[model samples]
Target chain A: MSSVSDRMLTSDPVVEVENLVAHYGSHKVLDGVNLTVNAGEIHIIMGGSGSGKSTLLRHLLGLRRVTSGRIRLLGHELDGVHRSELQELRKQIGVSFQGGALLSSMTVGENVTLPLREHTRLDESTMAIMARMKLEVVNLGGFEHFMPAQLSGGMIKRAALARAIVMDPKLLFFDEPSAGLDPVVSAELDELILRLREAMHMSIVVVTHELESAFRIADRMTVLDCGKILISDTADKVRNSANSRVQDLLNRRPRVEELDADAYLARLTGE
Target chain B: MPIWMHGSWMMAETRLGRVEQLGKRTLGLIAEVGYLAALLTESLYWIFAGVFQRQPVRVSSVFAEMMRTGVSAIPIVFLLSFSIGVMLAIQGIHTLRTFGAESQVVIGIALSISREFGPLITGIVVAGRTGSALAARIGTMVVSEEIDALRVMGIQPVRYLVSPVLLAMLVMLPALTIMADFAGLLGGAVYSAMDLGISYAAYADRVISVLKTGDIWQGLIKSAVFATVITLIGVANGFSVTGGAEGVGRATTRSVVLAISGIVIADMVFTWFLNR
Candidate 1:
């Protein structure tokens, strides 16, 4: 279970997405997007709102159809796969949704045990035990009986993490784990993410806009802007990637309201 | 140049053309709605027939669904029916008193609940509570990719998700209607006993004398139709939700509106047929 970052210096890509294009009606949400994540490495995808980062993640998970181009996971072409076969392919991957997306109707234990119940023929007691073990791993040991609605923001995320790794998938996709959390909580989640990758030896692709979280957890990173990849590099190299768009995003300043009041008034008055 | 004559003629022609366009559009929309209704009816028939195919219907899932629909909905249904019953009794008493027919208040309230109000109110309540909740849950699931997760897990969203809910509502709605009718009667009885100084036994007797099997069955039928409409509308709205948070919220609101509208239309059709 060596870190892929060490081996990524010379190795095959674990996930390959090339010239990917996706659309919502006439809007080209993902345009010629290309990305690669090496085995056992944490890859971060960062973008502002409507930058198609989430859309790209869905494509990687095969949740959305690629309007054009190619997406290959572990050397298998996703575009050529049948729907049933895609489901089979997806079992090898895990996803944690933007808000943790735990089934609110089900107890935390039930949520953790779902993939096992669906993909395996395990008996009830064994499934329960396995779910408990996963919960324990996420430090949510005693919260199995609680519903997802009852869990705190942090607890829900941990529970979702437990569920995502219940099957010990080869690849894990997390969507915005730190979006709504405080900085300290976000950092804690980042540490947990790194720990999970280390323990499971799984490749992770975290889709987020949080620069600090990406910088902390990512071994390699891609910056998506206007439906295109602005940069993809090692975390250390990415810091000095010197791409203007990426730098503009990472660099922050106070936004001054420099409105042209006369022009605005003229427009309002139908001038 | 006499501008007035030409302009008047042009305005008349424009008004006539607009009317014709609107009429055509309305007709086209009605035709589409009719086609969709036919398609849905056929599909539901096939689904119902499939239940009796090689593999017998699993009683457990249907039973669990029934429990969810019937048991969970009892409290709200009772409260609604109780309030309606009280209101109807009071209204009937006031109206009937003018003609020295205040005694007929029992029959009026009882017959209304048994035939119409019981089912209609229950249906609307179900739409507001169960239908909207189901839509929100399913819509959020769609937006979150949880529904897709289920599909990737090899579980059919219809079978695992919608069918349980549909079955639950179908089995439970009639039962809820029955409870609603009974509650309505109890509410009327309580109102009559307290407000009108009528004995409980007398009120019960008046209600019983006027209530018929047809009335009860009509309410039951309305409830069943309402349940079906509510479930379908909820699921359709849910599956349509796109984007993120705002889309989900909008879907939930739309589902309730659709469910309520569907219930009203279905009730009207049923009522018309029952009268015919």
Candidate 2:
């Protein structure tokens, strides 16, 4: 293992997970994972499908039960927090889901102001103004009255981002920010991510499979493979890291297929 | 193995699997109903306070929803109730003519509409329309994580979403039943005047003699209970949904069936208790 770099790491970790383990039925999706996301940094967890990156994000959000280990958000243990407390915690952290998770019943304006209405005593007019401000921040100004179904995929994602940041959360999490976007749109979203980081000075934890996106926006990245971290380093270092798994994932070269088709077919046909 | 023998074995296995699935689903549904009963007890406390407390109820919102439920439902309800009423009148006339008691057909139509047919038919129609719509809406919200969004927003999904529908259904079902009752009576009156060659006044007189306060109140009570059953079943099915569009469709169908059955059963229980 390579030694940890001195300058690449942050001293203040805002979110910390130790010996994290999670399971679904008998399948252990996350096995003894440890990671930290600090304030004013973008920590990207990159992995192939079924590599437990999303599972780990869900644990951080308290959306899933941690089979074992502790998740601390801003020095508070997330486990056993009351539902109301969890909601309060969630209000301070913005999470944009892989799919734009806008409520279909609500218009863009209503969706953005939901958090404000819930957490603040602001009157409806002020809340609406705040909602419009956030919408404009995400470059979706004046599209407030459109339904989620009516918006295009890119616009819906922006609306969701606007909703996520409506409260100016200290920590922002994105699950696959570029999973379904075209390259141009994805790059534009990357710019938005960078702009948000600069403007708010908030920590962002992005779980994504798109290597281009990971390299573009990530301050530091962790690559998960087979329920373990293969490598963790800055964007430049992770790209150059010779870990075969990371290299294969980053380079996008197909691995050799290992199945012996002839033998398998002979056994089935019995000829 | 012979193909027919293998096919028979597969059929048996499939049937046994289906039986097992049905058994599992039935048990799951019972457990869900029990859990929902507990939730509903708490929700009922909140709903009553919200509706009748010092704070005013959103009468405008409730009335708006009632208009949606009642107005859209009228054409279908009227069509069903009128046809049934006409058929019942024509059949009663044919049968009562045998005994030379043709005038008694007016009394039959009035008695059925006032005591049973009006509420029952209206309940079934609303169950199909409103109950299914409510279930589909809730199930869609569940699948889309909209209900979770509401919860995260510190709004109780039960109070914000379910309560509005329940109140609307409760208030409107009775109103719809009254309209259906009038339409059914009108259908009978039309047949009596046009086809039976009986004067409208004679038919109206017979209906007035048979109609009583108790008859109308019983129908109204049945409508209220039916509305409660329909709304509750819709909400329950919506909350139980698991997957996406397929789950919404399944919940809607299940809601309609459960609401209709619950209405029929409640009607039976009410009549039994009231008679005793």
Candidate 3:
């Protein structure tokens, strides 16, 4: 396996997020998050449930509006880009959702070829060949004829990955890639992520809560807590951090805070 | 003020709040309708742009939707229209007999079925069946993040998802109405012969004489408009879905209700205009 130094050849950052703030109605989810992903590196955004990692991912993908912040993807600022330009920008990015998000009505092959069919003027034969090649890359070879419903959880994830990379995007995003998969399958997916970086030279940003997967695959990682980033550095630096919250996360220890009884009662009763 | 007086004052304030809430809800409903109109306009823009730009229409998906929305609906539409036709004939017979104008029963059934019930009943059936299904399917897709996936692929959801279904509805609704009209007329003829002792030839002659081509055209036109309303409402609700599975269910129910109501209102407008 190539070291992080070898893959981080270019200093150009494919993704630059600065002081990003986001909200869900009245509730704030991401609070001043700053992140950068260098070209050809795998950057993992790891946090517990409701830690705003998913919200950050949504903002990065331009699926959600940022409350206050700047997000630059492939050198284009997403904050005020026109709709047509944003769409054109999206063609250079790929995302694999947590649930795979493959169209249930389409076969795996059809799903993979959808982007090409919509955007390219390639003949049907060329499109089919390209789709088959992507399926093979994700270890989903010969599964093209099957519907998404027929695939297992792991296969579904792989199929979604295949579709995401079918266009060979400059930047790729994965939301919980190894989630709900067995350890063996998860490890295989880790290997696939590494190979994709090596083969495609594409920057990858993955949002996950799986520490093992994060440690294994991330060239760099960010740890988010309560919608704020506690650490964003090399994986080794994050693992060796002296912060109690970071340690608690690394050691699988629950955060236990001492509470005042009166305050707790007041909060519960909205007094 | 005394404690009792304060309590009464609080109750009055609560009642005032309720009235204010009602007004707010009414305004919210009007806003939603305005938003839906905007969505319809955007969808129409994409549809026309696709046509003029020679974009590839997904023929297979449109055909599949046609099967689901039009073909699968045949049995229920036929059965319902047949029953309605029989009931109309029976009622017409009893009422006309009282006035010694029983022979006009055939004309009454023919005119009403062709000009009104044929399209209205077809629209209602489709709203309950295909419109609800469209909303549920797309709402589920939204909750599952499939819509986001499409966006990441640089494919517009309106073009990829809504357009094909819209095209299918446009083509199929009118066809279904024509089938329904024929089936209803057939049912009326059978009832006239068996229940009223009127010969089939006499009933057919009366229907042919009373039913103008203009009436059939009016029903077809009404159905076409209803098709647009049903599909636009369904796709709009689907896109607006939030939460999860429960949200999908709510959106589906709302689509059906709004589609049926919109169809009825559109029918009235079309009837008045077309007749005038």
Candidate 4:
């Protein structure tokens, strides 16, 4: 029943993205983006489709190359670092993909314990117990033998969350956690996200477009529009910002622009 | 400009454009070859290092691949080789009847099945089955973001995905070839008894006399080469797949075609060298 401020202690910055720019071919996807996530913080990134929030997350995860600028994760520079060192850095981080990317060939329990199996030589019994514990935390206990296809959308998301946190990663990145869920399930996921942060003391960065979920769980939030950050501030401040685009995003208003007759005629004529 | 001059200019321009297109294609081909070589080298390097570094050879994955590639393919390889053996016997009967050397059918079926058709038929069957399946499976994984998920988890995708299949193919292709060789010889023996009044004992005796140990070794060795090419092409096509489901489909088709072509080319080289 503690307030967010009472329970959260975010003093150390674990992720530092400085003027990060990225491109897909010649098309710029992330335009000089900067972000910081301190330890034990739950940072939400909000954007509509094609806003480049997902691209920025990919760059942060080092899945995509940076066009310019730098990113440091857990104090290791991402640019030009040796691959082995980057892999070592990656062991401390986890990502929950948008589609719940569980290996379809493996059972949920196997999926949850896969990271441990690959990286640790722990006893089979120990790994099983650890996987069950994480599954239980996600309210998916006793569903370990089920294939991922057997799970509902919400269950799949929860199972993915279980796998992401099974390794007790210091940093967690979740993409579109609530994209396909009902409001109730989304709320439950929001509750779980907050609980996970409080219990695990992990820094989390979530890229989502769901305003309700973002406002509910974000410790601090950033809103992105057209590959540019419209605002980055605490929940209360970001919600209250006077930026029109930010307001439009939160209020679900379509952007209105004055009509250009020449451009309209040109478009219509296929010129 | 004069009409004749313009005609000549257009023709000259078309020829120049064709040459430029050819150059571009050649460059693209070279780049693709380089990429494939790099992927193969990387996978082999990981396997080599993992073995020497005391890493366990992911027995379960390799075993699973072996079941899929080698075991599941048994029925088709056996059936096809048996059919080929029967046809070859019938043809041998007709051709050798002219010289009253129909007994030579024993040598033709035994030596050819052991040294050529056995590995060739097995290679084609595996190229159709395991090659396409591996490409489609890996390509779909790529499309579904499972591969990226693995990368994000700090696992080496090449080691986790490619190395197991490589080991499985290396072991299984030769095993299937040996199985096919026996199945084909059995078919020929069965036909020789019924059609040519040759007893199974006589057929076995002739096969034992003429089918040298070196002949069997040659087919097995050629099949091992087939395994390397099929796996490399399938995995390379898989890792290169782009877009979505359509991309996976394209990769699967390409894997089969290229693998079959690679097998034939490699087999021809082996045949030539052996004959020389």
Backbone clashes, each candidate: 1, 0, 0, 0
Candidate 3 lDDT over A1-271, as tens digits, reads: 2476455746778999999999899999999999988888899999999899998999999889899999999899998899778878988999999999999989999999998888788999999999999999998899999999999999999999999999899999999998999999999999999999889988899999999999999888999999999999888889899999999998999999888999899989999
- Identify the candidate with maximal DockQ: 3
TM-score of every model versus the real structure: 0.72, 0.82, 0.94, 0.93
Model 4, span B94-146: residue lDDT tens = 89999999889989999899999999999999999989988998898888788
Model 1 chain A: weakest 10-residue lDDT segment is: A250-259
Interface RMSD of 3: 1.3
Off by over 4 Å in 4: A1-10, A257-259, A264-271, B1-21, B51-55
TM-score of 3: 0.94
Backbone clashes in model 3, listed as residue pairs: none
Compared with the true structure, all predictions reach lDDT values of 0.83, 0.83, 0.90, 0.89
- Evaluated on CA atoms against the true complex, candidate 3 attains a DockQ of 0.77
In model 3, the Cα lDDT at residue A227 comes to: 98
lDDT of 1 by residue, B1-276 (tens): 379998999999999999999999999769746754654454354347634432223466677767766788899999999999999989999999899988889988988999899999889988998788877888988886678767655455665677667777887888889999999988888888887899988888787788888899999988888988888778767877898889888988988997898888888888899989
Best by TM-score: 3
Off by over 4 Å in 2: A1-13, A66-69, A74-78, A231-237, A240-242, A253-271, B1-23, B35-64, B151-155, B195-209, B239-244
Q: Which digits, one per residue and each the tens of the lDDT, describe model 3 over residues B140-209?
A: 9999999989888888788778878888999999999999898888888888888778888888888888
**For model 4, what is the error of residue A155's alpha carbon versus the real structure, in angstroms, after optimal superposition?**
0.6
Error of 1 at B276 (Å): 3.4
**Which residue pairs show collisions in model 2?**
none
lDDT of 4: 0.89
